[model samples]
Target: MSPKLDRIGSVHLTMRQVARATQNFSPSMKLGEGGFGTVYKAQLQDGQMVAIKRASKENFDSLRSEFRSEIELLAKIEHRNLVKLLGYVDKGNERLIITEYVPNGTLREHLDGIHGNYLDFSQRLEISIDIAHGLTYLHSYAGNARFCSAFGKCSNGEAMDLVDPQMREDVDEKIFKKMLNLSFQCAAPTRADRPEMQAVGEQLWAIRMKYLQLGREE
Candidate 1:
């Protein structure tokens, strides 16, 4: 159960009312909705556009859990590629998490699209590396013990939310090699086989540095 918000003076809002009261709304503002909730593009008072995720009241426990997880996790870490969690609201069944808007779109789009401007091999490698590094930090980056059980898992292989599988095929050989290795390390059948996120980040960094040197020489 979500802990009640002591403030807000018990503002009871229907789904429709809540939608209208949001910072902004339009067809273009719509990012995407998942099983949990719909995401909207809202411009803050400071004129910063943010993606606000509005969680549905149904599946109360699941939504509450996700809200709690996102808040707790995003609070500690900060990175370029990693999505930023701006803030959250929980008052009388109205739960929402405000996050930074990523205009570049998902890595998936760059991976598969007619847009002449796609993430080059290096960019693709960097994005994947960045994601791996972020996950690594999340897994081992200790936070308040109150939120123990650090149960975040990498959902990479599963159907990607942002891109298609066909695009993944055209990735350069070297990029594929590194990604395969990282995925394998993360999903090692034996828990012991999985390397810590910190270790993985260090390894990826080392590999990237070496690759850069090779390019410089050639």
Candidate 2:
């Protein structure tokens, strides 16, 4: 069964039980905490390092559903740009997902930093392609809700939003047309406008390749 269904069917457990059974976590191994849960830097008894994400306890079911969706979706896809899901420990209300530890930190952190090592146009193009490929895989194979899962998902999302807070910035003619179609197909008051993941991925791949090839010239 899918992780989402499994989580829903699970019986609730206390925090201590959750913590005790979680592998690789040490007292000093914390990374960060969010609405989702606390992330810790863990090293397996075999010396393999991983990022362990513990889901936060919440009264709301949507957040839990989102958590389950993320874990379920990520497990089925892999790409160079996407964070890898190594394994997971799921027992009732307490759940933990092991993932590759990206020490470079979140894209949001680096993008927002004052460092001169910012991504240039060419670099952005390449990174965009990478991100597009990752998203394409998710949409095509992971059965995500398309635009809901693609936008503002990483540092680029925040950067893009910050640069064009209103999303009114001008784009190329071809890109503009494609974006319009995406809006018509995926952005709707009703969920019916959402397209199949395969179609969404293809569209993203086409646009991303167009941008990436433009970078090759520079």
Candidate 3:
């Protein structure tokens, strides 16, 4: 284990303990499954709920490396919006990462899935601001941060298209546009061209405040 990993306050769980907590990876306990592996909702003996990610065996070496990288990266960073790594289990070919359970589900699910209409316009704007803050922290403090414009185009229509349909009608166009502009600036073609994360966070906060003010007026 690297010194960084050792320094992390996370507890290391044995494979048997993880299996028992997850009921031997029961399908009913599964929270989600992705390219990395399946995540299960587990309850520890101490009554703490956690999410455990178990790596698939297909690409053992590659997955192991990714697991180690994730541990190292997560250990160095701490943010309210980011998931907290609780621990990991590495026994033979099995690799599992344990993290704090997020009860409300993922942002993607809220924006595009069955929970689409659940969040109000103000809530959505606040979420956007929170994401920007998280990104800012990563860019400003995390050495491995990279700019990835995965959100979409910054054009008025294109940006609006990316917003959850339920939020579109109630969203403040002016604030939305400003948020898009900040996103565009952060995603500038070159690293040097991109605005610093602190600037992005400030801009996003300002947009959020404008949104809140508009809500009060209406």
Give the number of the best model, judged by TM-score: 3
Instruction: For residues 1-218, write the lDDT of model 2, one tens digit per residue.
Output: 11332332222223453354344355577878866688887654455566777777663355555666566666666577777776665656656776778877666665766444776788778878888988777665654344545444422433233234466644455554566567557755446667877889888898889877766765
Candidate 2 residues lying further than 4 Å off, grouped into runs, are: 1-28, 33-35, 59-73, 114-116, 144-218
Candidate 1 ranges beyond 4 A from true positions: 1-25, 65-70, 142-218
**Which model is ahead, 1 or 2, in terms of TM-score?**
1
**lDDT tens digits, residue span 56-174, model 1:** 66756676656675565555566665666555666667677666688776555667864558667888788778889887766655333322332221133422322346674433345
TM-score (all chains, Cα) for each model: 0.51, 0.47, 0.57
Report RMSD (Å) for each prediction in the order shown: 18.0, 16.9, 17.8
Q: What's the TM for model 3? A: 0.57
Ranking by lDDT: 3, 2, 1
Q: Report the poorest 10 consecutive residues by lDDT, candidate 3.
A: 143-152
Ranking by TM-score: 3, 1, 2
Q: Could you tell me how far off, in angstroms, the CA of residue 93 lies in candidate 2 after the best superposition?
A: 2.8
